[model samples]
Target chain A: MLDSALSVFRMGRNMARLMEGLGVTLEISVVAVGLSLIFGVPLGLMMAGSNRPLKWLLRGYLEFVRVMPILALLFIFYYSLSKFWNINLSALTVSIFVFTLWGAAEMGDLVRGAVTSLPRHQWDSARALGLSEGQVSFRVIIPQAIRRLLPGVINLTTRMIKTTPFVFFINLPDLLKVGQQIVEVSGLRYPLASVWVYGFIFIIYFVICYPISLFSRYLERRWAS
Target chain B: MRRARFLIVALALALAMIVSVKAQAGDLDDIKAAGKIRIAVFGDKPPFGFIDENGANQGYDVYLAKRLVTDLFGSPDKVEWVLVEAASRIEVLQANKADLVLANFTVTAERATQVDFAKPYMKVALGVASPKSALISKVEDLKGKTLIVTKGTTSDTYFSKNHPEIKLLKFDQNTEAFNALRDGRAAGLAHDNTFLFAWTKDNVNFVTGIDFLGDEDTIAPAVKKGQTQLLAWVSERIEKLIAEGFFEKAYAATLAPAFGPAVDPKSVLIEKLN
Candidate 1:
């Protein structure tokens, strides 16, 4: 334990370099999370929308994005989307869009499911009470839905953050790349530092993500109460 | 009791079977018996290796790898090419995924500790390239600036070590890293001159910045360390290849158009020892 502690604490230069990678992790997560926040509910509403085709489109698109590998999606956007179609999207922009599309659909699906799962009585009561559709959405449904949506959104937020490491492919320096560089620099001694290096990275991720987990759980318990 | 004992024995046998090491494609004896030497090289990095429009893999590295295979077995057809990428090359080698890597891998001192390298084949080092307005002509020029590089690559190592003051950013693919440099998010890309040449041809906005740096490095074929016989065979073949000016010819025919011809082949090629 002491050895591991020392290794983790001692590699300041390496850790500093790795911290920059955290910027990328945060960038993707923040952007994607922001995106999910903005559009995910709308996407969810679309899934719950009375229009069958739009719901199907949302479901089909969500399922398709979910099924495809994230790496393949990154390549498709970077190589195909820009060159063949003249879409001048940057790699970072594409990561944000692709991840947002993924997150939004997921968020939307979560919203749809949560909102639908709400008692039919809630919708009837709201309509009977003379609330307009917009009022029911903004004033009642979403507010009540937030009780449930909040936790799911938080969980999805963590998932998006954790998956931020995948940006290593887009060459966005993040926690993992720093670990790789440290191993390379340390040479044969890499294994000695490798554990601590990666462990620290894992911890950094956990630190960033654990609160989100806790927050999500707290919401779940409160909602249950 | 008799039935239980039989069942126990069967379970033990099954467990043993599961634990046994599976065979790999690079098994020399198996390959020899099968009359083929299966090798792995990159399928995308241009000039080094790439799939052309016709969907056939062709490049300087492939040509050289084929020539080396031909020397060993008397026919290039005895070679089977497997495609590998940056993320998977080491795993592929450790799993016996490829017999040898001639994928323009830089012979790093650190990598040498893990894998056996054939004799120094070509002298090269990491060089920077950027748009003309953003040209970075020295190591210090990259200081406080974002220098884009491929992840899990020697340039990543090179910049991390010698140019510690420079902020190094990594991309998984050369295209993305180069794109970063092109967009001016990164001041330059730290990579081999070959890649810089090819990328610049397409981007056109940038050219090689700073001639090159780090202890003069070499590009060599790497095999799993302790593959003495294989290592010796390749080292010997490298000598012969250099003597025949095969490196120069391959460069001229394949890479010269993009990189323009080498100014001095004599300085680049490793002189044959034998």
Candidate 2:
């Protein structure tokens, strides 16, 4: 179960090694979720407030990223851009680019739905207070909707952590890469080694994710009550 | 906590079963005498069989496979190229989907027993690749740093025995291992110096360390166990090809651009003794 950190501990490498692998996974998850929320909020606002063409386009793009597999999306970006244009994009850039596209779309849709779901009274009262449309969004609607967005942000992060393994596809040696490496080096003849390595990986993912999730749930309960 | 623990255990059991099933025995003669050698090759590994514009397989391995097919039945048409992955190469060969693997198969004792190796076509030693951020200049500099390599390749063994204390990030394919190194996911990547040379040659900042970990090893097409005629044939052809400068010519024509000039033809040829 502890195999993910076992090799590092057993090998007697510095504690930094374990922290480093975990860091990459966290970095990808945090950045992807942060960007998704940043770009998604604005896009969602636009989707909700804009004309038919804008709404349809935003909706379509969101549906596309949401439905398509992240692995395929990563490959299309990594191989196509680098090979055709000879653009040597760092793996970090590619990961961020794909995840942002995915994150933004999901975030945008959530924003769109949340904004639209708000009773017209929220906007009416803001205008009644002589506030502008922008103020109505920023001062009134968003303050409330942010609570809703928090849960989504938490959910996105958990999903991102689990999917970080896909980074292996683009050659990012995230946690899963470490597991495969330990097996290669240890060579203990246990098919169970991968289990130990990956089993530990899943735990790391869960430990990080569960707290975010519990916090989101806690906030929800506290706010709901 | 209780439910999550159960779920983790359940998932572990399921995955262990799958890995064991894939690591089972492989056969080679049955695949060849069936008239075609199904090979597991990388569809994206360059200078190897990768899909070209016409959707036809092209690259060094594909070119060599054509020779193997011709050598097998005196015709190029008798071969089938089956695209496989870092994790599936052994499984594919074992399952009889691929008769032998010519797809940059690295020869290691553990892997050697799983499937037999012929004469190595290319010679290389394990290398350590560090990004600009890390800029590793010496072997001991890598003392505590983590390194990444593809599973089942020579680097896995090389690093295991040589740098037991070092951290490793092992992936299923060259792409993943390279990506890990490229993205600062791992401090360095461990693999054949040829691949490191070919892969990192484009990046000006990255350079291969001069310290060779051990004796230079060769990469050869591997077939399953007990294919005496087939393994002998492949070994002989590989040796002959090395002597005749097929790899040199092939490297000159294809890989030299990516990996720099090919090593001298005479240097790579192996002499066989009875």
Candidate 3:
């Protein structure tokens, strides 16, 4: 049983291919998450502020994203966008674009929740000190919001990482794709190949996501104290 | 209000940029000017197009794709291999993501309307591979029985249209269909006879009892619809390859090894196109 389990890795560059796939997964997750933080924080601040039409527009966008499935979004951007709009983005580019759009929306909502949940006096006090609105936002409100939002951000990062496997549908060779490829080829030789390959992939995902999850918990505890 | 206006302007500009970039179908000149041909091939289906253990593409379709690239550019390295799933083969062409699709793409009237196919290099027909214990040898035997087929494949279309009584379980990937068959979730798995023959050889427990079904179909490379120049070039290249016995050589190297000596090469190979 053990021999059969180890046989998948004995195949040519299977481990290396898995590593390459992991790299792709991380690449998409990191870029999407980074871009989400960059764009989403400001978008969230706007949503929290007194901007009526802007809030309505942002809410519409967020609700649309929430209602639409990620898989459908991927298919739209990867296939339909090019066909209808005549703009051909590569599969990798499309995956990143879709993920960033999704991540940004989720992050924006989380940030809005974090900022809005804070005590109202913190904002009033900052404004009472003769600080401008921008100063009150950047100096007083944001710092406190970060403490509340970091754990959620890390959770989003993990969610984005996990969702990267959906790129396989669009033909991006992410981690699960590489695993499927390995299982397909190796199944010819070893009947137990899928068990080993999928089990390994499951472990790889856990190893990557667990630490980030741990760090989130650690921050929650640290900030609670 | 100012920020909202700015945001609206930014989105409008982005939309304008996207609209302004016209999608151009890659013709012979475009491919030559680009100095590379993007060819789509399957990453999972074996004996036709599959990635080897070395993480490099190895299969009959991949071999043909490489040769086509070499002949066009005088070097094999000028080809960008776009791995595709069965369902996305036509989508890739329509989207201009791939210049040609040589991914065991069986020719059909419905598909021809979407993408122009060159002369065929191989011929195929649907076949059913079932467990030896309860072998399915004929269409009548499959009545009321569940059959596994890959979505967007000829088998799926055939079973759905003609054999509606035979319940079908469809999967997006070839590997998943085979897995369903192995796990005894279905009575039989139907795919191209050429593929089933090769597959049954590796899998001793299964046998391709029904070796041929439906009308005989030709498998050929396809370019985006209206890409007349590329389509002409591909047709000419296929004739040249046939005259030189390139497919026979490819068969000997790739398919023969997978099929073993019992299977005749001429049965599946299309040496001359009418």
The clash numbers for all candidates, in the given order, read 3, 5, 0
In terms of TM-score, which candidate is strongest? Answer: 3
- Model 3 per-residue lDDT tens digits across residues A134-156: 89988998889999898789888
Span of ten consecutive residues with least summed lDDT in model 2 chain B = B262-271
Per-residue alpha-carbon lDDT of model 2 for B65-184, expressed as tens digits?
887778777888887776656665664444444567878776768788877788888665666777765677666777888888789777897778887988878899776777677778
**What interface RMSD do all candidates show, one decimal each?**
19.3, 19.3, 1.6
Q: Residue B196 deviation, candidate 1, in Å?
A: 28
Q: Taking the candidates in order, what DockQ does each have?
A: 0.02, 0.02, 0.58
Segments of candidate 1 deviating more than 4 angstroms: A1-12, A82-89, A220-225, B1-269, B272-274
Point to the candidate with the largest DockQ. 3
Every candidate's chain B TM-score: 0.75, 0.67, 0.75
Task: State the weakest 10-residue window (summed lDDT) of model 3 chain A.
Answer: A82-91
Question: Which docking category, incorrect, acceptable, medium or high, applies to candidate 2?
Answer: incorrect
What TM-score do all the candidates reach, one by one? 0.48, 0.48, 0.86
lDDT score, candidate 1, position A196: 70
**Predictions ranked by DockQ, top down?**
3, 2, 1
Tens-digit lDDT string for candidate 2 (A18-80): 456677777888888888878988898899985899888888898888788998887667655
